[model samples]
Target chain A: MRAEEPRLDAAGALAFKDHLREAVRDAPPRVVLDLGAVDFLDSSGLGAVVAARKFVANGALELAALTPAVARVFRLTRMDSVFTIYPDVPQAIAG
Target chain B: MPRERVRFRADLHAVRDALIQLERGAVLGPLTGESRSVILLVLAEVMNNIAEHAYRGEGGEGSVCLWRKDGAVMARIVDRGLPAPAIPAATDTPNPADLPEGGFGMPLIRVLVRELAQSRRCGCNVMQLCVDDDNAA
Candidate 1:
């Protein structure tokens, strides 16, 4: 799913988690998050991403096309090494 | 640097807006893309840590005083919440096979700022953060 916001704060993060949880409930074996437009991500936002990861099926969650800002959050927290990140949505879909 | 203190609620948007305004008020060369990112990430993590741990998720009112001094952006944040821990140690990253969530706030803040001092005075959490202007990503 593509995020449409410039910043994803606490409230937005929780809402994203809920949406992802619901999506995971009925999603395919693989779920990819398209964070192309999100420019600002905080700890709460990262937490939401992790929560979503835990909720999805094993080896199912993927993140694609992260802007530099969003990518930094994951990298700084060492989460970039944890999540299955893709260069873009197309590759994620293909893989 | 202003002698006057600028205060804002401890909510996410409020803190973020305040930081943006502070950045605009500075006359120095705009922070590099990496520097700006580090500053924002640090502030956001600290603020959320305050909201979650200090205020028990209430996100109570907090105050921020920012000024440019000696080519550094210095800030004193005061929150009417519990005393902050001496240092919120970074937890070990979970194994890839069993990744965990919700433990990156303190670690991120500790890494981004040049200096961080957290203390509890008068039953409040007082934190001082110093970010050098010349710092790069």
Candidate 2:
């Protein structure tokens, strides 16, 4: 999953949710969300990530290449504990 | 002291533009990139909350003010729509893959900002948010 732009706020979040939903529709067991390009994240963006995980059963959603800004959100929310995070896509894919 | 402030309608369409202007204001303030990131996140959550609950699609009913004091970035946002709700207490993000789809705004605001005060005064909802930047001089 590649986030298209820098800021992911309420306006951008809906499209993000739709994108993730499309990925989840016929996704495999392991899913890696590539967030290297996203520079900012809001609650709506975070909710979409969680919602995408819900849409995919068995907790298949994994996060990769979190920028400092994005990483702080998951850390502040303590969401880092919930998902498998990798430093980059290659690491996540290697697993 | 540099001028740092923003004003916008309480419309969903305005949120993105307002945030962009707010970011420009934040860059001129006494904040580092990291501190500005925190401020940006708080603004996104709170401003959208106003659009969803306070304005309820009624544009121009909400306004925001920002300033720097004692190394802390402060914001006071006012809205003439629905009364603001109490920010929820944060707990550990629930595990077990129980991913939530909604209602993550308030939690993010509380965790990111240091001084947050919300109240209803004279039929208007006022929210005061502050995030301290240690590197500010």
Candidate 2 off by > 4 Å: B26-30, B88-97, B135-137
For model 2, the DockQ equals 0.54
Task: Score candidate 1 by lDDT.
Answer: 0.74
For B1-137, candidate 2 gives per-residue lDDT tens digits of 45455777787668878877877774334467788888878887888888877777666557778887878787888878788787765634444345566655666676667777888999988888788885221
For each candidate, what is chain B's TM-score? 0.76, 0.83
lDDT of each: 0.74, 0.77
Top candidate by DockQ: 2
Per-candidate Cα RMSD to the true structure, in Å, reads 2.8, 2.9
Assess the local accuracy of residue B64 in candidate 1 as a C-alpha lDDT between 0 and 100: 71
Q: In terms of lDDT, which candidate is strongest? A: 2
Model 2: how far residue B65 lies from native, Å:
1.3
